[model samples]
Target: MSETHALDQIAAWRAAGRKTALATVVQTWGSSPRPAGSHMAINDRNEFVGSVSGGCIEGAVVEAAREVMTSGVPKTLDFGVTNEMAWEVGLACGGKVRVFVEAVE
Candidate 1:
């Protein structure tokens, strides 16, 4: 999904008084499915919109986003074929991605 659509989802969730977090694809290497700037917006309800890594790691990103929302602290997550989690998260495609997750006030 487009970054604009993701931002819109964040705004919608906030308007509804829901806490939200945003995960953004900041950097990518090799055969990344999505490019940098991709966004995924997750709400306190665990609902999400858009995607940072297509279908490869959205669940992991959502989990991280939940932590960011609760702690109000941003985190940068790295995933690559070299990492064991790449297989667990289904990112076995030889690519690396850096996702920055932050609570959206």
Candidate 2:
């Protein structure tokens, strides 16, 4: 989905007092599918919108978001796959991504 649409949904969720996390792709290296500023919103219910990668690493990111929700702390997470993990995660092109996960206020 488009970023604006995602942001709008987040705003609506916030208006309803839903606990939500915002994850943004702040950096990328070498052939990343998503660029900087790409975003995704995950609510307490484990629902999500937008994307930081092309599904290669979103599960990890969602797990990170869950941690942030529990700790009430925001964080920036970097994920880089080795040849083996890269193949497992499907990012076989040797790319790296930095995701900034924040608890929405």
Candidate 3:
């Protein structure tokens, strides 16, 4: 889906008093599938929309969103294929991305 649509969903969910987390790709380098500002929204139900990487790092991001939703704390996460931890999440292209995740009221 388009980023605008995804953001609108986040706003709508927040307006409806649903627990939601917003994840944005704030930075990217080297053949990333998405550019900076790409977004994903995850609700308390664990549903997700949009994407930050080429399906490589989304699972990790969702896990982070779950934490944010539960803890009400915001986070900035960095993932790089060159890093072993990142590779565990399936990012294997030597690309890097920074994701900002926050709870949405």
Report the number of the highest-TM-score candidate. Answer: 1
- Residue 76 of model 2 has an lDDT of 88
Encode model 3's per-residue lDDT on 72-100: one tens digit a residue: 89999888866668538746777788899
Model 1 per-residue lDDT tens digits across residues 1-105: 457998999999999999999999999999999999988899988899888886889999999999999999999999988877866885767889999999999
Which residue runs does candidate 1 get wrong by more than 4 Å?
none
Candidate 2: worst-modelled 10 consecutive residues by lDDT: 83-92
Q: What is the C-alpha RMSD of each candidate to the true structure, in Å?
A: 1.2, 2.2, 1.6
Residue-pair clashes, model 2: 0
What is the Cα-based TM-score of model 1?
A: 0.94
lDDT of 2 by residue, 1-105 (tens): 578776887788889878788899999889989999999988877888889888888887788888898788999887676534465454655688889998877
Q: Please provide TM-scores, in order, for all candidate models, with all chains considered together.
A: 0.94, 0.85, 0.88
Model 2 TM-score, all chains together: 0.85
Which of candidates 1 and 2 reaches a greater lDDT? Answer: 1
> Best lDDT goes to which candidate?
1
Q: Which residue pairs in candidate 2 collide?
A: none
TM-score of 3: 0.88
Segments of candidate 2 deviating more than 4 angstroms: 83-90
